[model samples]
Target: MESLHGKVVLITGASSGIGRAAAELLSSKGAKIIVNYLSNKKGAIETVQRIQKNGGDAIIIQADVTIKEQVNAMVEQALASFGKIDILINNAAGGIRQSTFMDASEELWEETYRLNINSVLLCSQAVLTHMIPRKEGKIINISSTAARIGGAGESIHYAASKGALNTMTIGMAKELIEYGIIVNGIAPGMVETPFHEKFAPNEDRLSRMSATIPIKRVAQPIEIAETIAFLASDASNYILGEIINVSGGR
Candidate 1:
């Protein structure tokens, strides 16, 4: 990726799981990474250390994307350090806890929407202020297949949140393209990451999930990260406002 060399990519929730994978892979391809973490300071530090160890340029910043103030501060700091943000990856989201619709609490739904959808709104708005002026930027969001399936399980709120994100991606893509900002999303299938640990912790459950996929396996974090990389790069120039599914044929 000749174009990726020295590009500045800010990745939210970058301390672990898919976020960490994107940060590491983008940095490996010579992109300068702004690794943002909300609560996992240890994981954030490890991500930075790994990038530095591999001779990649990176810096770690902690900010809860769900909060407007924190999101503002994080984007400001990135610009202060890097002068500009070329890519924005909205990956800061969670299911919070798994529970049936009847079992889901009002508080759980609110928090899930805050973390999953609100963060995307807040982060993209903050980054767009600068991107619009430059007339060039890439915003890649992490969505889920559940958005289409409607999460028959306890992840109804989670799926709903991502569904909102997917719609926003399409709208933003069309709205931002005239300004040279490309907004797209990736809907990854089951992946081997801490996400599953939080969502489906049991080994047998994971096995059952994997067996159900057409690939007979879950995705590795890097597999999803690699897709994000393509979306951020020049290779994705014509792909606007589309949600590309990376679900291993699921």
Candidate 2:
């Protein structure tokens, strides 16, 4: 494993699931972590505690990434604490539920776009200001398999949002490459996270969904974290503008 010693990583949606797992794994590799959460203050605090207990440095910051001001403030806080940000993990996202285009409300579509796509743009923009000056950075966006394969009977809006993120990642990578900023994305398939609890509340439906993966199992949060860690490390220095799929052979 490439050592991330002394590197500072800022992770959005760090309260739970993949984001939380990434924070813990990266911290273990000797990176100072900034846990950014919108409403899960308790979860963020717990993540920070766990990192500290493991002899890792970390801090929790609350910010709604969809808002530009909040994202800017959150990045400022991270820079103030660590002096510089070496990596940015855009993992914050809104939940998706089954809804046909005709059945989807305007409010739902707008909110989904705001949280999923807008947050990525705002957070990445905030990071670019500081990262460009340093001429080096790593940005990892947590997209979804829905963006690639499309989710059926569910929020097409959510999938659309993630699709936009993929485009943004590619565009930003091309634009920022000269500055030594690597931008990449991960499109995860049916992971076992609190996401199901919010989207598919029915226990039977969740079980059936898990059975669809070719690996015969849902991905663990740690699995995605490990991939993110690899991309953030020096080992992936040659990679740029790539979207890695972490689906268990879906």
Candidate 3:
């Protein structure tokens, strides 16, 4: 594995799930972590405590990544603490609610758009200001396999938003690689995260969903985190403008 020693990583919505797992795993590999969260202060604190307990360096900051001003302030604070941000993981996002195209309201569409794509746009732009000057950085966006499969019937809006993210990842990578910055995305399939608890909730439905995956089971958060770690390291320098599918052959 490539050493992340001394690298400063800022992960958005890191209070729980894949974000938290990525922060912990990266910290174990020697990176200092900036844990960002909008709510769930308790979970964020717990993540930091776990890292500190394991002899890692980390701090927490709360920000609504979808808001430009808040995103700017969050990046400023991270810079103030670490002096330089070597990597940015755009992991803050949600599907909000599940609804078919016919039942999806305008409000739901707009809200999903803001959460899924707007957050990535604001966070990536905010960090580029610093990464550009140094001509070195890595940006990893957490997308979904839904972007490619179009998601289930109840999540058309969410799937559409993620499809946009995939396009943005490619566009940004193409535009930023000349500046020595690498931009990429991870499109994950079914995973055991609170996302399912909040949206699908029914254990039977989740079980059925898991059976459909070629792997015969959903992934763990750490499994996806491993991929994120690889992208953050120099080992992936030759790769860019690509959305890596971490799905178990869905």
Candidate 4:
């Protein structure tokens, strides 16, 4: 990947997991980071501190990405701090628990869509204001393999929401590429993140799922961050409207 030096990156839900990892890694590569979080203020601070300690520039912003006004405000703050945003990581998501379709509530569906797809729309639109005029930028959406497999027994709602995200990624990629903005997505398989602790808390379940994976193991957050870093850099300049699967070959 090309150098990210001087690039200003805004990463949503960056308090922990893949977002945090991406922030730290990209910052290490010389990108100034805006770590956006909803409820995890402490994690956000830690992410910033780690970057700062490593001689990287970073700031934290609190925002509910699902809300348009909040997203706009966050972008404004990022611009105020960094002047411009060169990359936008639409990573803030997760609003559903493990539940079968028969047990899925309407509220679950609504919440999932708002968190996954709506947030992406709001953040991308808000950031585009800065990126389009410059005729250059990167937008990397975080999706999941469940989008293709249809999380039948658990989290079907979340799966559907990510499915919408994948489609939006392609659509936006085609629309924005003409203007020099590259829009792409990453569909990650099971990773040992807080997400599993919240939804699939059963250790046995995780182990079973791990055994089923072709690589016989789940991924780490940094593994996903590496791909994000790739998509965010000039190395992926020719890669557009694509959803790269980093699923251990599952």
Candidate 5:
């Protein structure tokens, strides 16, 4: 944990959920955080405020990760505040309303790919310019267990996007290792986050999902963030190109 001292981490969708948790945890571990948000300004600001109140450093920037221009600008803003980018966490992604692939619209497919997969590419490409020359950096992309379970009838498209991300992690890791950049991913199962509150609002939905897992529970955002802390540190330097499943053994 202390291995992150004085490092700079840029996390997308950092206004809430796992992204926000990673932001707070990394800051607490002595890394300066650049909180990236698309539309949740209030949540982003509060994340920064909480970090500062705890004697940690953080800055917030608003940008739609799906857009190349906006994604590039976000990286610029981070460099403006902190001269270098030490970590890049691709956590900005979402699924459309529940639907089978046959019922899914082309627009839904495009939107899902844009945010979940394209954003990862754009941000990683932009950050490499800074990371390559330094010969050291960590790029942790967030995947999902849906990639393995094929979305469990929720949305096949969401699964496809994460599957692509997991593949990208492996490809990027091989390409970037000579430069000292470690590329990896985390595929989380059901987690307690605003995402569930909005998408699975049933009083017993989490319980129902928990029943399927050996652990009998969904994850807390901070629990995922703890794994993120490990991947972001030198201690995990040896674990490259692998997506560590934080799915309670699902």
Candidate 6:
């Protein structure tokens, strides 16, 4: 992959999982990373430390993507620090717990949409102000396999949220293409992140869930990060508005 040296990349949810991995990987390739974390200060700091240890430039910022003011401040901070925003990885998301459609409450559904879909829209809109003038940018939305194949035990609301993200990616890609901003998405399947521990809770059930995948294993965070780095780099210039499934062939 081509180096992202000198590029300013903003990644939400950089406290852990695929977001953290992507921050480290992209920074290693010379991209200046803005590590945005919602609450995991320690994890986010460690992510920055890892990048700095490897001679990469990175800074940690705290923000709740679902909040418009926080999202605006995050983009402003990134631009203030880097002077330009080259890429955005909308990886921050919430509401991973499983719930049936009938059982899911209105609050749960609204929260899912707020975090997953609304955040993407807010962040993308914030970044566009800077990107449009420059006439160049890359926006990568982190979706999930649930959006493609509906989650069986999980709330339909979560799937609907991600489905909305996929739709936004397609629509934004078409709208932003004219301004040279490429929008794309990455849908991962059963990645071994702290998210599973929080969502599944039961170790035995999690193991059973892992067994269903064709690969017979869950993906490591770096596995998904590698794909995001590729999409953010020059190598994926021709790829826009497409959702790349990182499901281990499931």
| Best-matching candidate per lDDT | 3
- For residues 98-187, could you state the per-residue lDDT of candidate 2 as single tens digits? 678888898888888899988888999999999998999999999988887777347688888889989999999999999999999999
Q: What are the candidates' C-alpha RMSDs?
A: 1.0, 1.1, 0.7, 1.0, 1.0, 1.0
* Per-residue lDDT of candidate 3, residues 98-176 (tens digit): 9989999999999999999999989999999999999999999999999988986599899999999999999999999
Off by over 4 Å in 4: none
Q: Write the residue-wise lDDT of candidate 5 on 75-166 in tens digits.
A: 99899999999999999889866778788988988899988999999999999989999999999999999999998666799899999999
List TM-scores for all candidates, in order.
Answer: 0.97, 0.97, 0.99, 0.98, 0.97, 0.97
Model 4: what TM-score?
Answer: 0.98
Judge candidate 3 at residue 14 and give its lDDT: 94
Each candidate's clash count: 0, 0, 0, 0, 0, 0
Residue-wise C-alpha lDDT for candidate 1, range 26-115, written one tens digit per residue: 998889999999789999999999999999989988998988998999999999999999999999888998889988999999999999
List runs of model 1 lying over 4 Å from the truth. none
Q: What lDDT tens digits, residue by residue, belong to model 4 across residues 19-65? A: 99999999988899999999999999999999999999999999999
Task: Give the lDDT of residue 210 in candidate 4.
Answer: 87
* Error at 160, model 2, angstroms: 1.1
TM-score of candidate 1 relative to the true fold: 0.97
Q: What TM-score does candidate 2 reach? A: 0.97
Instruction: Put down candidate 6 lDDT per residue, 148-184, tens digits, no spaces.
Output: 7887476578878989999999999999999999999
User: What overall lDDT goes with each candidate model?
Assistant: 0.92, 0.90, 0.94, 0.92, 0.92, 0.90
Candidate 3, backbone clash total = 0
Top candidate (TM-score): 3
Give lDDT for model 2. 0.90
Off by over 4 Å in 6: none
Q: Distance (Å) between predicted and true CA of 202, model 5? A: 1.5
